[model samples]
Target: MKKWVLAFIAAMTFSIAAHAAIEVYEFDTLQQEEQFKELGHTLRCPKCQNNTIADSNAELAQDLRHKVYEMTKEGKSKNEIVEYMIDRYGNFVTYNPPFTLATSILWLGPLAVVVLGFGLIVVRSRKNKQVATEEKWDPEKEQRLKALLDEKNDGDKQ
Candidate 1:
């Protein structure tokens, strides 16, 4: 059993060593390389909605990465590349989407909810305080309640 475990560990080490090298892309200038990397981090993967293209391993993300590299090589501006992606995949492709009529809800919905939550809390707290302070036990009512309880107890005993 120990021998098998050692062999498995050795196999894993070799496999990891075989694939340890990071991928490097050739660029005419360091600025273009930096731009390509920045775009990869900025662009959201359509297939993996929560992950950027740089982090996602999905096939679509790979294609998008290649496309971004191609566009960068073609001397396309950052805005042009972003606009192309937005045109193809809609605003969901970018983390910072423009504030259009359609996207206003995305920006304002949380604010509305927060305001509503605070208003509700205030109303509830005020109501609770008013109930606590305004409540007064009447002696007559107390006497009547005690009498009713005693009558019920007597009836139960009987």
Candidate 2:
């Protein structure tokens, strides 16, 4: 395993030094390279956050890069390409997924939690306010306790 890893690293070093091959396709032009790069950076790796598929050195990103390159060469509309990738990989492919009933919860869940937390605080505050207002002691019970204390005091004085 160590030997294989070393060999892979050596190959990667060699590849890194090698230039990126610009495939000369009749349909694809160099003009579309900037557009492709922009689209690539917008896409997310399903496994990672903040790391664009273009920036990630993962094998999955390479496959996706190939797909994006082909789609761009084919002159498919940007929307169509984005839709295709989303269909293939789900909403996980996008840095931000579209808002719909299914996705609405994902987008709003945190806000909903904050609102609920606020509500709980308000309810707890009202309860606390009410707690100090109510008289808990029965007057009869108070009088009985006071009489017992006076009787004990009288015995102690004797």
Query: Model 1 Cα displacement at 25 (Å)?
Result: 2.1
Clashing pairs in 2: none
lDDT of 1 by residue, 80-155 (tens): 9999999999999999999999999999999999999999999999999999989888999899999987775654
Would you estimate the TM-scores of all the predictions? 0.71, 0.68
Estimate every model's Cα lDDT from 0 to 1. Answer: 0.93, 0.82
> For residue 123, what is the lDDT in candidate 1?
100
| Per-residue error (Å), model 1, residue 62 | 0.7
Compared with the true structure, what per-residue lDDT tens digits does model 2 show for residues 63-137?
787788898888876788789989998987998899988898999999999999999999999999899778578
Clashes of each: 0, 0
lDDT of 1 at 114: 100
Weakest 10 consecutive residues of candidate 2 by summed lDDT = 19-28
Q: What's the lDDT for candidate 1?
A: 0.93
**Candidate 2 regions off by >4 Å?**
1-30, 136-158
User: In model 1, which regions exceed 4 Å deviation?
Assistant: 1-23, 127-136, 145-158
Q: Give the best candidate by lDDT.
A: 1
